[model samples]
Target: MYELKIALRQILSRKKQTLFAILAVALAVAVITVMMAMLSGFQDELVRSSIENNPHIVISPQDEGEEFIHLYRYTSALIAKKEGVIAVSPKYLGQAALEYRDNAEGVSLQGVNPESEENVMRVNKDVIEGDLLTLVHTKYGILLGDRLAENLEVHIGDLSLIHISEPTRLRRISY
Candidate 1:
């Protein structure tokens, strides 16, 4: 009790020192609080962006030389039957060039069944223009990346010729 009284007396004697000490502590707490809020917000944004942009799992051909997955329909069906599997989408990738009017741009082409893709990827959510259902009736239809479409000067409903050259096959698609 005697020591506590002395300490209190000492603190009260130095009024300016006590004020500065309290201010410093309060400022530190305020700064820390603001920093924590900012860091939490940044972390949430990063997680949301990752979830929105990336797939939960990606299955690729085991052999690097293999261009296509064999019996993809059977594989997709098998995967869909597995526990915790919600949907499956089989895709084929190739390199192609899109030509529209005078503009031409090389693009990586991805072919996917509209129904399966919608079930797995929810592609309709990301579409900015035109319905994904358009591909169902349109033979040899394609969806281009935004940058590729911009480079080729093409828009929805516009016709673009796609030339795909592979070691085994060469094909052209018009849409």
Candidate 2:
């Protein structure tokens, strides 16, 4: 065709421009491909790390004053039966004040089934001292973090009294 011949002649005449144009297109494609791959990798890494470190979802009560979650056992059992459900842990969260003579520290407390919590959180991995598993056999036992223990001026095996304030009542936790 006459048009094709003319186009070929033009491309041949502008050899440097044609080559530069091709290189530019190839470079653009390469950059876009690399960027897409990097973004995908970052997304995967973020998802994996987040899932490993924390729970994917948490089901809680609609009422703020509701300390107890009803049907939690059934809910946990049902969730466990689902596909790809790793672990289920029911937790009772409370804010309490710990008093040891003149030294008093307000702390957030968590009551959990140790075995299930361990399966979900693997909390024992972070322990610098003491056994997190001992909670299984511990009755009214308290596991204090090193920093919190230092702040409260307490040590291992030290007995202390903690005061927990509930939504409608104030209660004392004896340890």
Candidate 3:
């Protein structure tokens, strides 16, 4: 009891110093709390946005060198038969360079069924100039993303040549 009283008296003698020390600690704690809350909210929003923008589940081939067609077909069937599956669409992705006269821009070539792709992806809504559904029955027609189209300087109805190097080089004119 005597020691407690002495300690209290010492603390009271340096009241201003104790208050400033307490205020500094409080300021640090408040800043940290605000930073944590903001970081948590930002992280949650980022994750939610990424999930919303991308596919719920992605089906890819197990082996990289193996034929993706067979894997995609089998997976599509299984996905279609699954209980919670809303839709299933097969895709063939390849990298290529878009060339028109002197302009050359690297791009990704995505082979997808336009009719079926609508149910699987939000790409239909993302088409800025051309209708994605138009490519359903058209074999030579390719739907380009806005950024891709801008890089190539090609219009909706304009034609562009895609030069793909898949083991060997292949060129195809796409509208």
Q: Write the per-residue lDDT of candidate 3 for residues 1-175, one digit (tens) a residue.
A: 9999998998899999989988999999999999999999999999988876677877677778864757567768887998988888888887888775567888777888887788877676767666778776566777766666667666666666777764333232333
Q: In terms of TM-score, how similar is model 1 to the real structure?
A: 0.72
Q: Which ten residues in a row have the lowest lDDT in candidate 3?
A: 166-175
- In model 1, the runs with Cα more than 4 Å from the true position are 1-32, 166-175
Ranking by TM-score: 1, 3, 2
The CA lDDT at 111 in model 3 is 80
- Poorest lDDT segment (10 consecutive residues) of candidate 2: 166-175
**For model 2, how does the per-residue alpha-carbon lDDT over 1-175 read when each residue is reduced to its tens digit?**
9999999999999999999999999999999999999999999999987878787788888798786779999988999999999889998888887765578888888888878988998887877767767767767667777777777777656667777654333222222
Collision count of model 2: 0
Candidate 1 lDDT, tens digit per residue, 5-26? 9999999999999999999999
As for lDDT, the candidate ahead, 2 or 3, is 2
RMSD of each: 4.5, 7.1, 4.7
